[model samples]
Target chain A: MRYSKYFLIIIILLSVFNLYAEKPFKYVETGVNTNSWALIPAGEFHFGQHQHIKNIDYDFEIMITDVTNEQYANYLNEALEKGTIYAKKDTIWGYHPGDPFDAYLHEWEIPAGDYPHMPINEPGLRLNYENGKFSPKAGYENHPMVEVSWFGAKAYADYYGYRLPTELEWEKAARGTGTNDYPWGNTVKRNQANFISSHNLFAKMFGDVVKTTPVGFYNGNNYDGYQTVEGISPYGLYDMAGNVYQWTGDDHPKVHYRYMRGGSYQSYEYNLRVWPRNSAGPEYTSMSLGFRCARDID
Target chain B: MVEWGVKDITVKLLGLDLESVERSGRIIMLYHVIAMIVTSIEVYMITSIVPMRKHQRTNINATITVGWITAMIFGMAFAYFGHNYFYHGLFLVGQSLIFFAGILLAVTLNPWNKHFLVENKEYAHTKNGYDLERIAFFVMTVSMLISAGFGAVTGSFWSNGHETFLAEDLIRQPDKTALQKSIIGYLHIMLTLIAIAITLIVGRWMDFKGKLHKFAMPIMIFGTLVISGGVWSVVWTHMAHTFIYIGSTFVMFAALLLVIYAWGKLIKDRIKEQGLKNPSFGQKFVALFHDPIKFGPFWQMVFMNFTVSGVGIFMAVKLEEIFRVWPAREERITLTGHWHIPAALIATIILMYYIDIAGIKGKLRKWLGWTIIIGSDIAFAAMTIMSMKRLFVTEYYQTPLVNWTMLATDFGLGIILILLAGVLGWRLIDLFRSDNRWSKESASPELELERTAVLTKQGRDVIKKEMEI
Candidate 1:
């Protein structure tokens, strides 16, 4: 009877090993393509499923894919050396100005000081810092950098003179002037994006790996026999509705919480809608939380 | 930019619709599955029942060739997923060796030349001295020859098209007329001829020696002649539909005659049984016609021939024309649902044959045939109807009420097919593991007849070499 616990542990260990052993499909993420940018020009579009029209007079550029592990690792190394960021015992910490609180009904003030950006000690963190340098785990270099809190994501964007897109900017970049529910048009077929239970090619080929796909994975191609649908947004942005929930720049007036958009891979598809806004504290982070950067045009 | 299945560039250069090739290319796999797995196994079993020689050498040669063909074709199925077609063209050469085993059967059994001796009695391959099957075999052979010749024409068209049009670097549509004609001829010959041959030959296996079979020969011969000669008649006369109908009608008429002859004999046998003496009204009604429950492969094949040719295609086509259903307008859903009738049920027949080879009797063998055969035919028929549902009906079918009904129907069918495969696998486990219960049976001439029917050439050789020592 005592051996049963050992047997269970052995079973779990085997399953976890099986999960990582299935190397990701090449299309899952072009880890290198994260540097590419898409320009969303000034326009008024249906802001949500309710057709609330909103306009922007200025243009802005945004990363086409999520911030990949390699991109963030490079940022971490630079920040560490430049003394812009520092590490605690098991987490990389960064400073943030506290969020405002109206103290309305349930609103509590988020007085930020030193906050943990990412917990580097966990198994799920794909970027590792060692030997006075930060490097992405081998073979996971192109996957979206997860375990990133709103603060960590903001710090990365600010380090590069970019900012997390406001909710308006993120929605415009994703939905465009098109009155469609998704980044593409009306329909969302399996494997078109990497949301939960998408049964994308990697999921179909190796059933064990339920982890994140590499950024920009759904560009249409038939590999061997598996097929994928083109998944770029209206303005050429990729993974606008999946991969990870992007931390947006908005700190709501009395909500005291940061805004997130484009639901993560762990989210049910309804949360991926352009108007279906998700929010969390500035310090909150999870395996499904990550962000991209945006900057205004001169 | 065409987004599904292989392009089949060779067929593409011919100016034919690539979608048709992609969709219909799968039908050949069905035909060959029937030819190799079910029909070949049936032929082997029939060799024991027929009035033929032990056919030691013929059987040996067949064991080697068939074993090789099965392996190659099985490899071809997987190779397709890997993008290797026709086993990189080697499968074409390898599969043609079936003709070699067939010719050996013809020569040794000598069913064509002399009567074979079975159990010290003259078991004539002929239907009580009728020559219809012989004529059917001849017709099938000539049609096959025409198919082969036109296959060459198809190849030549592709070769020439590759140089003249495909290689010229301009993307104008080449004339696909001649290539279409060749393909049409090849496919028509194969389908119509194989159907005609199977219809004629299934009767003789039951030893049905009736005068009705004598009349079926001429009608079928005329049908084969019209189809073989009219392969390209559509190009000149533009009456391909009329000619195909005339040919098909004759073929169906011949099959109807054979089916009547068989059922007539089966009813006669049941009526002659003494157990029905002074029977009730139900018994009298049953005596009037044979019970479907007691149906073996022969009876099932006869019923299959009638329903598929006589009723199935007729209704499917009528529904398509009159109702404007799906599969008629849809490119992917095949209108020829009759293929599914044979493709699905013939596998059940293979299970029955497996039971016979294993000599496992009682309830397992007794009820397995009728249960599977009845379930499969009905389920496939339901599937054929559902596939033809209109777009409106299909949309409505997504409703909870309709979806639940469909789920029940699907689960029922799923159980039948799963049961068939499960039973087959259960039997195969013994053979594959070689518990030696099947392998160590004593070698008598009777045992040789049974053993040779089941074992491979290597197994036969091992037993023969052991006996010699």
Candidate 2:
């Protein structure tokens, strides 16, 4: 009787996390936008504003803009259709038993936990899930996909056979081979990137309520009469230093956190420097945070 | 800013002994106005002004999507808990969602990314001036953030100050200095932004031109920023008087630039008239005063921005001293009228623009437009005169003439607004109920297209004649 009760308890806990969430268990090849990749040559690049040197042995492809709400919305619908993900309690979750835990200090493990890709509801959330459908809010489809957890960003990358660039690769892309302070150049202006108090139109229009600007918003163009300069890296990657912090794949030995590079709309100019870094646990999300993905050159 | 929490207190019931201008009420009211009115209007402005891509519009829609929830929560909190932190918390959320939409709207409207300007060499450096309206709209967005920041701070940190929901406080409690100052600053910045938006709209409609236009933008932008920074700093009690003066001077200077630009247009017309065969001075002068289809002297009248902003600054800076004066009844209304004047101005402008776009018969349109313009000016002038009662010897302020003048203007403005509403309402009904033959919406396609074609031909003929000359 005692053994049977223990077994029942185990089953109940497993059901809570949806441990048996159906996984595609098959490779989901390519991405929604297959031709958006900008190639970075395989070579050494002075990383972190030339504070150090780093090298990548393989050429890589990265996107020009942060993954947007519209893209994420599209992905969520497709993922639901493919049964690679499931919606429960207002969250989109999937089966991901990728990490190996070794009982290190503060380390956690699971045989198979239903990892949440994203909660459908959060403050400043740009994507809405209603009536079994996920849709990007109107007028915000191009804004960076935010309020998404690191696992969510990773899930998106995985579905497309892309990987979040490690921090070193990110640094390489932003600074290129130079020691520049910003992605565009050594010097920065108030409107160079969408940082706090930059008084960019987004800052002005939304008051303190809204903060994020659209992806690739820094590309050289005069929005109306307001002139904006492009913030592309030498590798043809855009938004390498600002817009939103792009999550990078940098799992430590035991920690559940993933690294995010590039200062966000809420960050200051200094935070936007090519060398700076910030981090959060994989399940963490925010209105001021988002991610882009990269793939090894094929 | 007057609190309307007292269920049935009409304008006639204004307490005689209210001390300072109530500010939390203004915050509440502004929060109310933004959710109900400003957001939709701004969306219209963004859609009308910005040539956006389908993707950008979709993204903007998402920002607005969040705003709907934010606004719903706000409506509940404000309706049930107007005097509590719950209302404020929801306001902050709505502020974020709405403001985000605005920023996104601004970026999309900007044409540089579209390469539209570069592709058409004539797009930039036009003979009239650069299309600087987008820059103004963007700056206005910043002001939205700055003002809301002040309001949120006041609402959050000094929650106790706004706890008193009685309409009678006029918020005169000395202990609420932080609250009053912060909200006062908030009101000023937003008012300045409103003026900028109006100026941009009118300037474009009037084809305001010359080197004066160039000077106006840079100077106004600087003035606006300086004022925003200074007013915000004053809220933090940073050399409050110094910033007040500097901010006031720069803003006034900016308003003066707008005024000078308007007058310059007037002068240019007069000079050209000197060379005309008939020199129709009387007609030109009348048109300048209230021309719905062309340049008007109302641009000059728009200088009321300076007066109101100065009043906003003076009231904030001298609140302590003003309170010490143990103000009389008439003085209280003057303070009330300080806000009332600008409120009237913005409404008048809205009506004029409606007249311009409503496609009403020209004579009827002119009468309606002129009534608002001249009526608003008269009401403002009367209010300004009554406010001057505080400067006169106390006995003179109590004269029957002064009392009657205040009553007259207040009633006059009410009647004018009522008249406007009646006409506008009937017109709207007529429009909705009319057959496809007369409604503007019905005429939007082929009729509007034919009108545009005729105008384009006339324009081309004028250009051709100028070339011949």
Candidate 3:
């Protein structure tokens, strides 16, 4: 009995020794710049359409970065496979008498696996391109996917139980804590961001073009270092100016096509301004468009 | 005449709207003084009382007293200077001396050592004088020191804000420029997490042993350290001085009180049973007050520790969020509110105490203990919710009076839990102390009992190692 007590003590001592010597698991280094996703301490910041709705305010939590390939893939796979749609048409009646299947239905293909769950023309879906469909055979998994339609992005988010970043959320994250005309600041620079600063549209062919670099590639020069590649925003989101234009959930009349902010690598310098609105058709998926995602606090 | 007071730096840095730092600091000092006095008295009792009665274990009592007193003095000095490195160094030296002495005592005191082993080699059956207790003690002590050293070096809390002592160039500001603030915040947070990890190890050690005593000591020590640090910081610093001071002091007092309560068991043994049984009420009262429950467990010791510790931890979490905002809010990784695990463990200990008793037999005792455990769990959840609501929601305005009232409610809940736990522990201890043969068998018989005892000893050794005691 006495000997057993000693034995038990020895076992306990050994166990304690083992616990003390243990170490924690290491997170993988993705090599992606994290500046755009820098943490904003808990506090309030102004939110709204900076130019158009100057007097109005709509507060929302914004993501520091766009849904990366890793996070987006999870949502895309889950939502598209299960066939759950977040947005039904907000119109009064089910459909117009002369409409074919449904305008919304025609815009999105939320089949089991083939399509994303976003709105057909939403900018978020513009970033879900794989190897051959969007670009030539130069697609890196870590690189943002492009060519997904707006509905495709919304459908993908809805399928996976997420929503398109509302205009308020999107702008807040993009222009974090600042009223900048672009993600970096009011003034634009050539080397600081990836927009077509030289204003030569015929400089490079589509296939032979300089491909978009990974997010936060130019983080060193980000004006605030708290948001994106060009850095610094009122709500602290990256790439809000020039990396790629993002489509918000809201429709705008000034932007006759769907609205796209954040000028792409192929865009002219003027398009890089935060207030400059532009859009593309639902079927058109370009390499110069991509998006970020946001979630509700609750 | 005014006693020396620590500057309320916590309020300055954290920007608390309520409570002045100076007032909070004084309260903290009072608690510290009370705890120190209680601990000293416990040390005195361990030296003077136990040895006088338990004649067979006189040597053990003497060694424990000397070791404890030395550690306490060393720990106090270290706390006074706010130098963890020095505290750790002194702790190691004191613990080593105790270990060496224990080993010597085990060998010299063993009767078999003189008769066989070293003196006679002709007897083939004779073995080397390997005292398991000695080996376990030494191994456990060394392991404790090793783990503690690792925890101190690699641990986050040790590194957190230690830069204050690191270099003249490196700034240790509660509030710095945004750039400097981010860096400091990240480092400090990381360190605090590491300290928490180390503390969890102490809990894990207790879980491994299943013996309440082994785990209790480490918890007490950890609680004491945390409490002392909180008290010191509340008094000394200017950054976040008032908010941190009040919150930390509450946490500190709770921890110290728990340690004393757990140790109250030792005082109980000395008072109720050891000091000439069947004495007068006055004599008992005198013993109780002098050799109070500071360094040992009271009859309901385990539960008191649990409730105090559990609620203290929950409150501490709320306090932490109030003082500092998470930099990674977008990530949705809020680091707070993990006190439930310990609360559960404490409840388990109390229930187990009841399980060991004969008075609570069959399904009824099991049902009662379980009911208490479940009830306590519910209370804990409610406490957590209340604290969170109080801290996060601006609509629920908590004045100092209301806050104190809520805190008192938490303490009240804890006391109730302790009462239930006490019922169990008291019953179990009663069964053990009795000459109840059937009850003894029910607890564990012969080989099973031996195995359990051995395992407990081994488990304690491992726990000591884990604690870096």
* Best of the candidates, TM-score: 1
Off by over 4 Å in 3: A1-59, A80-139, A198-208, A221-230, A252-257, B1-469
Clashing pairs in 1: A28-A214, A29-A214, A31-A142
> Candidate 3 on B136-189: residue-level lDDT in tens?
222332333333333234323333542221111122122333333323233332
> Distance (Å) between predicted and true CA of A152, model 2?
76
lDDT of 1 by residue, B1-469 (tens): 1212234473456443322212223334434444544434434543443333455544734663565466456534523333344453554444445444544444444324323212211221234332344445555655655565575456455324422211111111123366565665565565565555455445554354445655676677788777666765654555766787788778767767766766666566776675555666666556644434334544556556554655546554665342221211121233344555555555554555455556666666556655666566556555544544433342212233333435654764676777767765775676677454445531321322311012335445666887899
TM-score of 3: 0.27
Please give, for residues A106-164, the per-residue lDDT of candidate 3 as tens digits: 13222223322233333223223333122112233344545545655555455445566
Docking level of model 1: incorrect
Which residue segments of model 1 deviate by more than 4 Å?
A: A1-298, B1-39, B42-64, B67-78, B81-86, B103-130, B148-176, B184-192, B221-237, B278-281, B284-331, B334-336, B349-361, B391-394, B397-413, B426-469
**Model 2 spans > 4 angstroms off:** A1-298, B1-27, B34-43, B50-96, B109-133, B156-180, B240-255, B259-284, B290-332, B396-399, B434-469
Instruction: Kindly list the per-residue Cα lDDT of model 2 for residues B105-195, writing each as its tens digit.
Output: 7676552332222222222222333244445455656666667667666656544535422222233322336666676667666765665
Local accuracy of candidate 1 as per-residue lDDT tens digits, A1-298: 9799999999988875565554534434343366889999997988854567899889899999899888999999999999888888888898988887666643555686888888776556777677978887766777888878888999999998999999899999999898777789755656777775474445565353446767887788664566778887899888888778888898766554566788767555555656666666666666677899999888
Which residue window of length 10 is worst by lDDT in model 2 chain B?
A: B445-454
Any idea how many clashes model 1 has? 3
Going through the candidates in order, their DockQ values are 0.01, 0.01, 0.01
Alpha-carbon shift of residue B416 in model 3 (angstroms): 96
